[model samples]
Target: MKKNNSFTIRKLTLLIPGIVVAILTLQSCQEDETTELTRDEEIAITENATFSEDVSDEDIEIANSAEIEAGIQEPASRESSSEKCYATTWDAATRILTIDFGEGCVGPYGRQRRGKIIVSYGEEGNYYVADRTITFDNYFVNGNQITGELYVEKAVINEEGFYENNYTVNYTILFNGGTTFTLNGSRKREWIAGVLDDNFANNVFRITGSLTGISTRGISWSHQIVEPIIADFNCRSEGNFLYTQGIKEISYSNSRRKRTRTVDYGDGICDRSYTIAINNDLITITAE
Candidate 1:
């Protein structure tokens, strides 16, 4: 009996040591876990700190309001007026006309440049009474009046572009209101006086400018970006009259990337049509 009791006490002593060792191991693991969490928090805080400006909200609003009034929020420059010089003919018509830069260079009747007041009249029948639809193509800033020709034709307005100006208009001028008169589209290649020289029409410099840039933002006059147009439709005219048009693009694009492409022919015809080039990847506006 004494021998058995001695064996049992030895076993108890061994088990007690194991239990104490296990308790110490568990306590070490808990401490290690706590240390890991503290280190992780320190690293996260050191790596990701946010810095903020000291300005208040009211100051931000004031700065934005001032900038909203200016068009210089411009991101790029497309100015070509440095190489070429230009002037305009003033009539009350300059305000209504939409100028397509290239299409107006030849100034025939290709694409619509500007729109004007149309005086139309209709009342029953055959006394040969007629009214006129006035369209301004070119204008000059004279001493008092900006003068230009009225594209007198029967037109139906199509799409309006960057400016409040309409794009497509019917080329044929048919007066069905009374005695009908048919007006055929013609190109008027008129050389402006005192531009670069007398024979400015023949002068080929370079077309390094654009026409529709500043208005792409949104023609609604509400949502608009004032980015400038930068392209040079560089070429020569009959008299080597240096001509260049500087355009500014200030419109938003659905693609979110601002585009500076062109969509006009060198011919100036309001009612004119154009055929696109297959491989040229360029737009060809025409009077056909």
Candidate 2:
């Protein structure tokens, strides 16, 4: 999708002031020798949230398509093939939509997936104006099992004529090695662009709010989006999808003490590099 001119301008304006502050902040701090949360734990927490966001959006897209196909709404754009790797069924009586990725199928980013995503809509039975609850049935993505449900309240159009909703996620990922990652929180999502398109690659969303979870290694953490995050579906890093741009404040706590950090996803670049600031310590990560 072409860049939205107004949004692009606003984002660039933010970079001007942010760059100066970042430089000053970095120059003033000396790197710390140790961190409360291990590098792996930090990465796992972020990755788990990214995975949940991707899956939640995918479920919404599929349900939107099902609504169009069922004549409940007009087509947004051409039907997307992202979910074509699976079988989808709609039960009008129950207001439930199911997308089944039998045995296994390759999904976005070439991740192997299986099982079913069952979505139920509210009385309106509409994708745009009704609430949606999505649950998984023995779902596994790339050998990691996903459990729990994602609840999305009905959309409310903002003054700018864009749809906004509150998304509550109670999710867990159990890795093949038996380690687990879990997230339980709510975030506000705004459809900033591409609402008329069925293809997700053209979509862009802005997210705000906080999430608290346990990383794969059992570290307790809380993350708050200090700067609204831009999840650009058009951008992916090394086959692992992530929020293209944003700033978030993350806090790690255990029995002894708490450590707070700031993470920046960068200036809307589609690269793997991101910066983390923990007190006097500065770390740059380029996902491998």
Give the candidate number with the greatest lDDT: 2
Model 2 off-target regions past 4 Å? 1-36, 62-72, 81-83, 236-240, 279-281, 286-288
What are the lDDT scores of the predictions, listed in order? 0.24, 0.74
TM-score of 1: 0.18
lDDT at 173, model 1: 22
lDDT of 2 by residue, 1-288 (tens): 786999989998989898999987665442221354666656556656556656656555555555565455655445654435677787879988887889998865456879988888889747868898988999898888889998989999999888999989888878889988888899988989877775656777888999888877667888899999887766641354456788988887665556677888788877667778755777777642
Lowest lDDT block of 10, candidate 1:
49-58
The TM-scores of all predictions, comma-separated, are: 0.18, 0.78
The reply for model 1, stretches above 4 Å from the true place, is 1-201, 209-284
Candidate 1 backbone overlaps, count: 70
Error of 2 at 203 (Å): 1.2
For model 1 the local lDDT of residue 36 reads 34
| Full-model lDDT, candidate 1 | 0.24
